[model samples]
Target: MTWLLVIAGAAVGAPLRYLTDRFVQARHDTAFPWGTLTANVLGSLLLGVLTGAATLGDHRLHLLIGTGLCGALTTYSTFSYETLQLVGVGARLYALINLALTLTSGLGAFSVGHAVAQAMST
Candidate 1:
């Protein structure tokens, strides 16, 4: 049952990731991967919120949202590859910006999500 639930969540998340990536990438003319960054940060926030909610209730919720949906939605490999591409193409500054913004904002969003969840639970 757990596996089934996770699989279902992934089924939704993976396509959503693809669509979102394409949509965001299309709107921007720059080399920076706004799509991937957006997905990663959103996934991190959602995972943090789900994990926080698990503290107040069911573990299955975390398994479904955090482990399943987020797992498929965010791609560390794509982030790494894009960063490398930026370096290889001489956009070193963009690479660093992407790295810094993604990391900092992801953590910031996650913290906010966790706090929201905690507040809701209390």
Candidate 2:
């Protein structure tokens, strides 16, 4: 039952990830993977919220949303690929930009989500 729920969530998350990738790629072109970065940041936020809530309530909820959905929605492979591409193209500035943006945004999003969840519980 739990596995089924996770699988379903993954199915949804994967497609959503694909759509986000396509949309961002279309808008920004294939030069950089802005789409993947956005998805990962958003996913990190959602996972933070889910995990915080689960700590206060139910674990299964976190498993389904964070571990399954967000996990599938954010592709580390894409991030790695983009970073390597940046280095390969000798775009040191762009690679650094990507690294800083991804880390900062992801951390910010996670903090916001955790704060929100904590507030909601109180």
> Among these predicted structures, which one has the highest TM-score?
1
What are the Cα lDDT values of the candidates?
Answer: 0.88, 0.83
lDDT (tens digit, per residue) of candidate 1 on 1-122: 89987887798889978888999999999999999999998898988788767767676776677778999998899999999999999999999999999899989988988889889999
- TM-score per prediction, in order, is 0.94, 0.90
Q: Where does model 2 exceed 4 Å of error?
A: none
Residue 58 lDDT in candidate 2: 75
Instruction: Show where candidate 1 strays beyond 4 Å.
Output: none
Among all windows of ten consecutive residues in candidate 1, which has the lowest summed lDDT? 54-63
